[model samples]
Target chain A: MTAALGQSARSVLACGEVRTCLLPSFQALDGRAAAQLLRLRADEHVRVSERPTMYALSPEVLTGVDCRLPTSNGSKVRAVGTVIARAALTEGRLLQSTAYFSAPAAGPDTRRPWGQYLVRPGLVEPFGKLPQQATVEGVLRGAGRGELDLGTIAEGLLTQLRRHALLDRRVPFKSRPTHLRWVARRQPEGERASLTNFTVAEGGLRTMELRLPEDVPAAAAAGLCEDLALHDWLLTTVQQMLDNSRIGAADGPSVVEALHPVVVHLLHLWMPRAHVDAALGHLWDVLEEKPGFSRQWEKLSRRIRDRLALQAVTMPHQAFSPR
Target chain B: MLIFAASDKGGTGRSVTSANLAYHRALAGDDVCYLDFDFGSPTAVAVFDVADAREAAEDRGLHAYLIGEVSEPERIDVWAKTEHQVLRDPPPGCGRLVLMPGDVSGGEFATTDDNLRRCVDLLMKLYHEFDLVIVDLSAGRSYAVDMALEATAQPEMSELTARWLVFHRWTRQHVAAAASLVFGRRGIVAGGVHRGHDEEALRGAIRFVRAAVPDPESPLWSQVSPTQSAWMRKTDGDLKQLASTAGIGYSQVLGSVPLEPVLQWREQLITDEDVLDSQIANQETWTALSRLAARLTDDKYWEEA
Candidate 1:
């Protein structure tokens, strides 16, 4: 069923948006709670994995849209189909939701029955020939007014999960959410998938472009982007915390108090490619080589540890001093 | 934390004062979202001076989002979009200030199930992303207030903290009407209880802001004759006594904004530039707004009286 719906369409373009943030619960959820939180449908079973890391993924849900496709040029193309959205929790601390859809090169000019669209999830059928380049640019740039908006769908899912009864609705620390918008253009079946461009813009926006083989499903691309977005959010949040800590200006105990959340919740979450499929795991190599994500994370981890150690050594003297 | 700003009358300075509170909170390094829930008359766009967003939000504002016309409402970044020369450049280390304007053509409508659900979803989303969410409601007993009460009563929102501030001018009629609006029959407390809110808890969460109050000791009023001065002091004392009898005494009052000519002439934020450089707005007004903003989340001020 997955192959029939996700791969048999010979999709020419794939686009998605991933929103990542810390789960708003004071305590991290266990596997049972994580699975319950990500249960998007009653009848469908949520996929839970615990091999390399604890992770739970919700079953795919569909949002139907019959609106103008975002185009870089002034051309207006109305598309009618369903967009797929799913939620995933990593280590019960970070929650992510992705809304994505794939499109074929062209489709029938008339609309089909909603039942027909429901049968094939995550496929948005354009009325006519899909302007592959314009749509790609448009998705990266973001949807315009009255356009197909994947961010809204993803945010809606996130909001739904955060309101689950199991959650305590309290977070240890406050941090902003990050949004990663990505588009993948299909190459020949024999070509290898490669990351083309990644730009980090202001206001927690990140855009990624990729070229993937035709045999690879769009769901895999979404998975790869989700992984990237999750790590990016971790780095961004920790960096913000450190910047706000005022280490040199503030006293030692206060700085330690500020960085305690990172040490407790985020340091152990840096296992890259832990949940990604092996075929798409190579995409992390480019990011690993130039501006090493793990390297920066390790340095940050060391700084936090050294501060804690120093504070421990000086505890006796500080305790003896006058308040 | 969610703060709902409601007023009993139209000229109570509810929208402008709440917008300023939102501004002050953002300047104090808390990411704040100001929602224009005054569906009948959406004037926050003009107050924030975001002319560009005024056009974009005409069709895709909170009204459209609540009515299912749009999936998401348009959010205008006040610091980036405000045409005010002083607000254009925010101080470093300050947090974000976002304004979710109302539709230009939006009007008051009865609450529906779908609308209530959408309102809950929007509030939950904002609560997660923002450190403080200030919702400016329409005046008097309106659909906006009803929706707010219904949405907060939902089980999903029970875990979040929601507070209300009823604004009124410093007049005997205004004070009496404000108290009745919250404590009278079919008032907020009664309506909240009907919607499944605990009466004591809802009453505890509600506070009042007395706007446009004239102080007899201020220089602006010192030019009056001795008879006028005595009469002013006597009226102020009588009003205070009347407020106490009306059940909205000194303890229930959050803060009061002095009568400033600038706030009367123009409904805009009282920035330091206005007080220091331009010399158009009063320093006392700025200080009062700052203190009120700080007290919005202060536990000491919000405890049961």
Candidate 2:
């Protein structure tokens, strides 16, 4: 990012290009460490969104951890602590555990892929962190022209958290985040909440927090028990938002809005018999749907067009030739 | 549509017909995949004059896939060998010819039927991604032939619709082999002819190379008569009756291309003109052949024909 920006004030993070990355999350990895990993993706010139914020995940999976005041999901069975790609890049670490995968892993060959991967293995569970906390030790490695967008990363991690049922609260079917909690920790607030982050301060009012509630359903809770692609999608959507915002276009909210129901439909499409085949059919049907349900998607897509207009993006011409 | 081209014997015009038909289909703007499956000698690759396609075969050449090397099956390359051909270039949308060249270096067949089936599976995948798949099978029945036929018979084999075409000269022996290889019940050789050798010419090799050697006036033609004529009559009778039994008939038999040496030389790199004048105009021999190629793609023309 520093090299590509080359003293150009336009960007020192991303060199001003629209990059489509299918990022993976990790467990036992810190947010700073994940940021470090992001910086290593120097192949594409990325333009950082001005005043972007970090979004970290510490989604608490119901487990053996103790609470000062007894929590609502009961005393607990065993807490699954995890830190994935989003958590590692956002708040510096994750609070809970989930099956997180990483990218371009320089670690032991865990059969991880390099780019836009569907499944790339990383730490199995908690990178050893707690909620509302940042990791100073064992952290990720990445730095841009400025601080990374952890909020978008955190949002993306929410998808993994939701998919892996890493959250402490029960989610309803067809549930979408009606509101986002932007609590900034260690930093002052920015231009707008579109680049929202949980603002955690030492002795200040703006600190990151989660909304835990009583009367949350068991099936919704049980949904947290199963691994779902929708959860992955949720995090991916956030990453898309963060990436776009970094280049001065944040599409997080609308994509979240459009995809939430689609996610639900996708979840329900899975059946015991021919589960994969049936689910794909539903997915194709919805993906190929012309004149999409809402104009919000079109509005965002147009913004993507404008963003794409910002630069000369290229894939190796050799990649298209048959090997 | 997938055109599985095969012949009972070596001298049969299988490759010639296959190349011409593929040329026409490709010319019509259909993305075509031409796979040379003659694993033994791989005559189609040489005939298509794409034998040198080996230069581009580090990718998934047909041979490489058979040997478990490449993952992606590439298209046939229209090599520069056919520089002297009639057509300057093949048909238009006429992207690069993805020639899945044969295993020239190996000189061996697929290890097993399963491996040959894998080759067909790869071809079918190409068909799904492309508009047509043309498989040039070996001269005689081989595992490649069985897999190709089985692929066509099985509905779930591929998204590509299929038509089985048997190429043969208008000679008695060629026709006999063609009829028996596919007509009989057990697999394709239901009523098809068994292996037999042509008699040594006491006089000399017949020079009317374009025409069937057994001239009616020749005494060798007489010596060939009674049995072959009886067999031809029986083949006609059995095919008529067996069509009902096997639930398929001679109508499904696409057509036969003539044995024309001049036309056969540039068989693989079929020019638009080569097929236009010869593959279609040779009425006595290739009469039904051009019509067959025409119907393979255009469903409306098929309705009209």
Candidate 3:
């Protein structure tokens, strides 16, 4: 009986974190292909050359170069994006990147809503339900002192997005590109530096040529985009799983396991004061009758340490304690 | 593939270069994870400041995971912290480079030897979650070095597929010492250890390099680089000896990050000559570096039979 008590206690200790089945989040569904997708979401990297963005104002003062700041981590990464606007002396090249969604922006739909999307200019195709509003995420990567543009990766992304029916529109030609001004004298080989952003308009990719948001401290605000995406993806995934569970029967524990992070993120974003308590409370009750959920959660992560244990039961406001 | 950034010497830009390479690749749209396996220094925190990373034993870290102590993998706040360090305006969505920071607790560095095996398992798990894993070794090749090698080696211990050695040296003596250390009596001389190079091929194949503190004002910094031309081309014998001696490949010989004076004095971080220039200048160096990074990406090289 003593040994049995020890085993049970040890099991309880191991069962601190939640264990739910890894269910497919509906947010990733294209609503077309039902193929099981090994969804590998990618983060973009745009290295802004350390060179200053050059402004023309006409050819006289056009001698200066445009460059963004360094990373706060003391890295040499530069920002890259579509040139949203330009002011010879103000915003040299307003580079911006955007993402698109297919659902209505209501309580964060099943599809993860990236605050914005990399939509094609002038073309809002049917992407399920979310609106095709593209907003440039954070500067994913700063250009190293060594990287060069052999291939217009930006254009390639736009083109690929177009082929995938992901683009909103195209920009026009006669693209009078605004450029980064340079040092007084020009050097040879490898030192030839210049960069500019272009807008994806109805015609083709074109420079915004006006009303550009000046450098948004790319390095300082990096990863702002991915975190939001991750949050959205998780919540939408959780919501979808919850929706799906209403139809075909689903394993209680497994569904909760993959979705716990999503729900947690949602609580953190939408209702932080009670997210953990609420989640843990609901889970404790939901899982109390289902030993399988607790057992499986404990088994899968018997060795994992350092996370707050989920309270087995909900508590009144005064009773709900923080770990 | 696992790219081990090691140097017998300290402060050789191991962490910085590792971080930048991963950052650049992620910008190319590849998934990358940077592991601060430099448990000894644990500088990724001071350097990158992963806000969520505990510089102590308070929470889950590389330490707990290696000892089989962690219940779940630590969720580093890349977006809130180092992720911003990678991009200018924190790329709106997710980022390609993810960081697996080392334990901040200085005591964690005194890890037991066998723990490396567990660490490799953890790294492998992370690898499946990322396209590339960059390990910033503790200045010297500690147990972490052995773990990296074994992790990438063949089943029978013939060679490592995802293996590449970056030797950072400034002066001739440092360069020569780097070559010797990696090619000492019990060094890379253990021939046919891998399929790449032999002793004779490795003599001059040592990847001699200086830290990346560029003094744009200097003549070397101002001119067309990569055209800096080798001080002297290695003869076939010299090349063979270096390659064979070091047991590396010509391709695995990731070149150098030029010694920028700006880096020498400030040694803060790499940016442009000034913020004025655009179009990341100097093509050949980054290209060569990129090629080296690309090699570390192929899984066929590291997986055991």
Candidate 4:
């Protein structure tokens, strides 16, 4: 299928935005409820898996866009096509929705019929020659005014899922959501996919760049980015919890109370590359090597355990001792 | 949490005071998003000192987003975009302060089903992202107020917590007008109930904010003659009795902003520089606004009276 997509017209660039947040429910959803929440289409099926971790992936939905593509050089290039979006659930504890589109190098100058664009699920065709480098830089920076806004589309889907009646609308703790924007440029047919750069910016924004072979589908790229985003969110959120816990400044029970939610809802959600294709899973190596995602995670995990254990030892003495 | 700021009449300091409350909340490490829903005349851009946002939001603001003219409203990071020296360099550990300005040419328009849905969607999205979403509605019972009421009454928004802050100046006429705006026929309570809001729950969430209150005991008024001071005290007592009779008594009041020459002369956020360094704005005004910001989510202040 991916080969068929490549045969139609090799995509020069693939870019997407992923929004990761806590499912606004007090209790974590079971497998069945996860599927029901991620059912984006009435006719399509929501894939569910439980072996590695409880995860649900929704069918793709398309949004048509015809606007000026964001470019760094200020050159205006009109594009018109459908942007595909999908939602996923991890252990029913975290909810993520991604909006992405693939674009070829160039297309005819004139606009095409909406029906023609609808057939190709996630392909956006530029009206002229695509400025590959400029477009990649523009996407990494983010959409400007009157430019194609992937964040709105991604947020629209997230809002829809959060409003579903299945959710109880109760969050165990208050934490900010994270937005990860990723761009992948096409490499040669046989070259291995590589992760180029990853940047952590202010206000919970993360950007990543990748180079992938022509045979690997954009869907695989989206899956790989989603896995990376999920793990990044876990690390960011847990680190925040520990920082705000005020371990040395605040009292023992108070710090324990603050870290309670991390242990209950987030500590077990560190499985990386669980759903990415085998070809793209190696991208995780780049993150694991320098920053050592697992190493920092293990450190946080142990700190939380140590704090909880200290609380366990101090609870009885404090409760029964004379004041 | 969502907070709707409304006033029965203009010049009540509704917009400037609520903007200050938003500033105070953000300074205290809570991510806050302030929406300029005053569709007729948007002044938050000037208040927050984000002049660049004014030009960019002329065509794509909350009005454009609600009417479907744009995909998303323009957001100005107050810390990064503000021209004010103090606001430009936010203190460490401060949370994000975002402003969603209203369209320059936008005006009052009746709320339709589509507009209400979009409003709810925007609020829900902000709720999940920010800690506090402060929507500054146009004064009186306008379309903005109506839309906020109708949107919060929807089934999907039932689980979310929404509060109302009614601002009024401290005077006989202003107090009476503010009470009528919330309790009279076609008032917020009546209008909210007509649109499927539970009367008790809605009433529990409503609170009053008295702006520009004059205290006769303050040192600023020490030079006044004995006759004038006596008269001022008597009038203050009378207004208190009238407010209790009107059902917006002491318990119903959240906090009051003192009459500061700075806020009255130029409407802007009262930062620490304005209060301490420059000594232009009063310390009492700063304290009141901070207390009000903290009491916004305090259950003790919002409990049934």
lDDT of 3 at B164: 44
lDDT of 3 by residue, A1-323 (tens): 55532322110000000011111121222212211111112232212212232111111000111122222243322222122111111111111122211111111122223222223111111212211112111111212222212112222222222222221112110011111111011113233222122122211111211111112221111112222222223233333333332212333333334345433323223211121222112323332244333343333333111111222122233222332
Residues B50-153, candidate 1, lDDT per residue (tens digit)?
A: 97867855688999999988878888999988999999999876778999999888999889999998999888768877889999999999999999999999
Ranking by lDDT: 4, 1, 2, 3
Query: What proportion of true contacts does candidate 4 retain?
Result: 0.27
Error of 2 at B248 (Å): 11
Q: What tens-digit string does per-residue lDDT give for candidate 4 at A59-142?
A: 999999999888888889999999999999999899999999999988668886888788887999888788889989888888
How displaced is residue B24 in candidate 4, in Å? 2.7
- CA lDDT, candidate 3, residue A126: 21
TM-score of chain A of 1: 0.94
Candidate scoring better on lDDT of 1 and 3:
1
Per candidate, the number of residue pairs that clash is 0, 67, 112, 0
DockQ value for model 4: 0.36
Which segments of model 3 are wrong by more than 4 Å?
A1-323, B51-59, B83-88, B92-94, B107-114, B153-161, B188-252, B261-305
lDDT of 3 at B70: 51
Per-residue lDDT of model 1, residues A199-270, tens digit only: 898778999999989888888999999999999998888877766525534565666676778889999998
Those runs of model 1 whose alpha carbons end farther than 4 Å from true positions after fitting are A1-8, A42-44, A112-120, A245-256, A302-323
What would the TM-score be for candidate 2 when compared with the true structure?
0.41
The better candidate by DockQ, 1 or 3, is 1
Worst 10 residues of 3 chain A by lDDT: A11-20
Model 1 residue A91 lDDT score: 92
